[model samples]
Target: MSTTRRLRPGVPVASAPPPGARPVQPGLDELGTPLQDVTFVVVDLETTGGRAGEDAITEIGAVKVRGGEVLGEFQTLVDPGGPVPPYIQVLTGITTSMLVGAPTIAEVLPSFLEFARDSVLVAHNAPFDVGFLRAAAARLERPWPGFQVVDTVRLARRVVPRDEAPNHKLGTLAALFGAQVTPNHRALSDARATVDVLHALLGRLAPWGITHLEDLASATDPVPGDVRRRRTLADGLPDAPGVYLFRGPGDEVLYVGVSTTSLRRRVRSYFTSAEKRGRMTEMVRIAERVDPVVCATPLEARVRELRLIAEHAPRYNRRSRAPERMPWVRLTDEPFPRLSVVRDVRAGTAHIGPFASRAVAQQAVDALHATFPVRQCTGRLPVVPAPGASACVLAEVGRCGAPCVGGQDAAAYRPVADAVRSAMSGDPQDVVRTHAARIRTLVVQERFEEAAGVRDRLTAYVRGAARAQRHATAARCRELVAARRTDDGGWELVLVRHGRLAGTAVVDRATDPRPAVASLRAGGEHVPAPVAPATAAHPEETDLLLAWLEQPGVRLVELDGEWSSPVRSAQAVRDAAAAVAVALVAPPAPLVDDTPPASAPERRHTA
Candidate 1:
């Protein structure tokens, strides 16, 4: 069960001139705030989304204080010129309906800045909230005004030290300060509560001979954990799904994750990640914060996770955060076309697919090439050492157009070569080229018998390529919903049901999603606690499998080593498997005796 209600302001706001009224402003300490008073303006903003820079703000809340007593307060919901994302609205309780008539940041910031004059800026997670303010301020060409900033989150960990407080979330600290927060998160309400917690925390800090303002300013994060405090993150956070960020001392980002479980537990697993034993654990003395965004559903979490991983590029999330270069199977538009690596727009490539892996691209290529062997060779192909090798065996076998031996010219060979390139680039009409050329050659030579054979072969090839491409494409989609297990006790075997030749790995389970691989680096099992079962397939593995199965048409990103590549055709794989099973099951044959039937073994009759 949950409840929602408006919180009566704890401190009344100072009277101001009317709406859109302006006031005097001053600034000093780094983050665009003055250094004079012990005052702090704790801020929180509700916007179109959690992506601070890309998403615009719909609401802003700033609490003004001096000498640890509230002096003024500001709150406003701004019209962002767009509807708020459903997920953001759910988190902040500030929907588009609520912000339709509200003023925008430009209209509100001028007044807020005047009210914030000569005060230290504050926020629970200063980097994120302030980041939005700075970006918005930048659009107006206003310098952040270099205000000295202080984080109450940093203070609580230093003064209230305990293992139970490892996470130090706003909600937990709010309760600790005798300030209660209702369920639905609203901008002004949360900002006010953060201000209250800072005051409460400052009161406690006084006893540790830490009363001086300068002493607090010099403090940084990655503070030592009060491990003995013993707090559980799952029990602390709502079950809502969202993205999480791990910050070490001084607010250096360590990792990021998406979760449908307790934010605390999801983050806690990172403390025990298989990679942690390698490089991640080196962060033991550094992490001072765990920031999270609780969304309404798992779908939002997934979307946010992908976005954050790309934007932040956290150190520990390499597999999720690495840059994605959509792979494509390139077929050059040359006289004797050849396969080549390419990205972006180019006039020459006849075919290319935007895949995540080369293997998938290769899979598409392999299937298409057999059907459309139109390109025998190309100009760009690396020249072998033979300067006068004359046509190699490929030209002899009819696989090459003999361009090296001067048998063909780029202009004359352009069309068929272009067809081959297009076929490998994921075109479905690949097998048609074979029949077209055979028909034309037959018409010129009057060779009806060979033309008929070519037609039949072309038909079979097209049908086969289409069928294989259909399956490969479906497998790619299945990867989106495929099951995954990261905490396996042994080599994470990804079963390739399609059984391909050059059997490429379809799953990579480590911090980097690559082809299916064996990591001697991860020493034992990384089995998760029994509370949650294994699910959600690794993208790296699925991407790799897709590349191999769809090769010549699609491809996958490379793996760490020689992966468990595919076995090509499914029928051939099944036959081989059956043979192995039979060999294992068959019993030893009986021994035969070479003796005349009438004279042999008469002693047995006595029995």
Candidate 2:
């Protein structure tokens, strides 16, 4: 799709400065196309229902206008491929019979798009009409052109007074603006009315210095003067995927962000009301410059953003502020290993979690304890207990094997410790099965509160274990190379080392990927082997990589070590967790007796 920018008919062109003279800097007025020069396609649509994706468009009408002159008009009836509701038919006066011989949306979309091409889209409620058009394009597997949209409803709300118009509806705005064509719920008439409303709103805004197309956004949203002045900070940024940092007075990073699309557009958005976060507004106010770090692929940009956030710990960046704070459930090194929630991972310690919180880690520990006869006490147990050491209540209650008091020798408890280690490592079936059976027993006994607590603990343990195992599987691999086909038929190649996103590159379609793959492997960051059961990278970063790898059509190009999970164990736990969740939500079945009372008759009564 092509977009054309045309100047107003009578506007004069500026001449270049003489060879010796200094070049003049352009002002904000010269930043974008003037309103009079912009071609706008006033559009309207009649759909089967209010929803965009689910409902189908029945009619499309658009008027392409420039310099207050109607250049061309397009109108078509579309076969929605479904029955229209009676209310819709009545409101639109377009019944199913009227659409019997009409072309389908797939047939009508191309012509409509061509007609509206190179023009800003103007609509009464822009999202409603544009959303349907976008949905149609997506359904047909066509790319929707990036079009500037102007919602006349929003403009009217800002320009018109409540005393002059009761509401900003299309009909009300049309009458208020004295439009020649009145909207009657039909597509073409509504579109024609919207054109007049748009022109009238623009005229009202013209006196307020909204003569340029770029000014319309600010006019509708009313951005602060200070923030708007800083838009120039993005003037030199490139239109590419990258990480951007907002630096403050002392050149200290205040905020960090990443953009897969044009970095300039993304940074410019912070000056508009589109960025509504109070903290971000404050950050932008104090921000002096925007620094861009361009990357070859979006994945690389994202990874760089994460690293920058971690390094700077920017105040405005709430996420990735303290990845080190993620808690892990580790089996400590001892004669009788116990689950301990620690912030760091040590070599040779069996671990299962980088859970969201310490509380969640504790819950998982409780679940493990309920299943395995591991010691729950915080104190460390010896290889041999004191001569007269007594067993704790946990041992008396049979909850623990009390190796602390020598009730069970290390030789006898070795199997139990090994089982716990196995569960934390990969095989969690024993733990899952034990927890599932106990939860079922509790539910049957009508101990619902107790069952819910057990269910939570079970869910926490299973989810954390599954996540940790997946991360560990990836982190243990010495090196891996993967590729996925991009939307444009190009290839997105990634190199991973010890689960860290080491490098990424994009290979254009029809180009040989071997060179890029070779370069990525050669230049990728070096990541040493991580401690056992802990990922080399932050858990969050590893999680992102795993999700990307699991996307459909991702192909593993190379692997140095096996990347696998205990499928049966994880799946069994997931199934049991899902069943318990359903059982908890549903009301319990009442106990029914088949035998009737001796004094009661088994006769049916007539109403």
TM-score of each: 0.37, 0.58
lDDT of 2 by residue, 1-607 (tens): 3323332232212245788998778886578887768888989999999999899999998888887777888888999998766435435667677899899998999998889888899999999999999999999999999999999888887767655876789999888878888998889899988888888888787767777888877776777789888889989899999999999999999999999888999999999878745567779889989999998887778888888999999988877677789899988888888889999888886887788889999999988998888888888887889788778898999988888877788788888889888888756766666666666666556565566677788888888887777777777788989999989999999998888998888889999998999999999999999875577787778878988998999988878887764434443455445545334334332112324476553321121
Which candidate leads the pack in lDDT?
2
Give the alpha carbon lDDT tens digit for every residue of 139-174 in model 1. 878877788778767666665655445457888888
Q: Weakest 10 consecutive residues, lDDT, candidate 2? A: 5-14
* Candidate maximizing TM-score: 2
List residue ranges in candidate 2 displaced over 4 A: 1-223, 434-452, 571-579, 582-607
